[model samples]
Target: MHRDQPPLRARSAPELVPSLFLDLDQMLDEFTRLPIRARFRFDPDMPAVITVEFLAERGPSLVWLLGRELLRRGVTAMSGTGDVRMWPTLPGGRPASWLLLESEEVEALFEVPTAELAEWLDATYRVVSAEAEMDGLNWDGFLMELLGGPAAASE
Candidate 1:
């Protein structure tokens, strides 16, 4: 077992949430029951970003790279702006979260289960703790390349 190989990294399990296809309408009364798959991932090296891939029955998948902290905070309260936004919602007496992705052409709303979101966040945090995120960044060499400094760049 002493082969001097790279250490095995823990990966956050991708969450497949069943979300209704809904448009950004004020009433929000109607929603197609057709479910879409949302794949979530947290790269340890890119600790600050949270990647989400929304897969639908038709058309191509949409990939979103958002702030991990923003998503975590959104779990409890409304967070984010512009292209992404999230907030807790209780529909049909069930606890869930609403994730809205907006673009100039179109927008989509997803009702994500709060429990599943919590679980996924927990797993991602376990894989790369908040404190370790700074250390995980490869900012040293890259910054040096940008600043033209010698070795040992981090403070």
Candidate 2:
């Protein structure tokens, strides 16, 4: 999924903000069931075609999976808190491309994209999947770390 260029801002105001709830299982399921070809466009005149098969082939990368999950769930709108900031180092103690999802209530960030996010999704997926397999852990736990959601306390 190679985007022709960087994502261009919409000519008009952003869409209405919807009440958001994080559902990781649902997000993963949706990604798995994605069609062979998906199109995303800020404007109807210009749409980027994403090859779902390519992403699926590589398996899930934590960063790419988070990006895809956020995008699929329509979580892109920046809340006007002005709290979001980019750090050279991520909270997970690694230097990876990512975006900070910040607010007064939460201190977490996810991957950012060098290319169009859609394309980065596929690239990261390929790398992360291989890394996870090599590390001998299931992708789910690795994904949970990258996502930074509520983790159940170990008894």
Clash totals for all candidate models? 0, 3
Model 2 segments more than 4 A misplaced: 1-82, 87-96, 118-155
Colliding pairs, model 2: 97-112, 98-111, 98-112
Estimate the TM-score for candidate 2: 0.21
Q: List the residue pairs that clash in candidate 1.
A: none
Q: Write candidate 1's Cα lDDT for 46-138 as tens digits.
A: 677877777756899888888888778777899999898998875565567778888898777777766766777777778778777767444
Candidate 2 residues 1-155, lDDT tens each? 12223223333212422112121111123234222222222211111221221122356522211233344222234322244333232345432243344456654443332234435444433433423423433345445445663352121
> Candidate 1: lDDT over CA atoms?
0.66
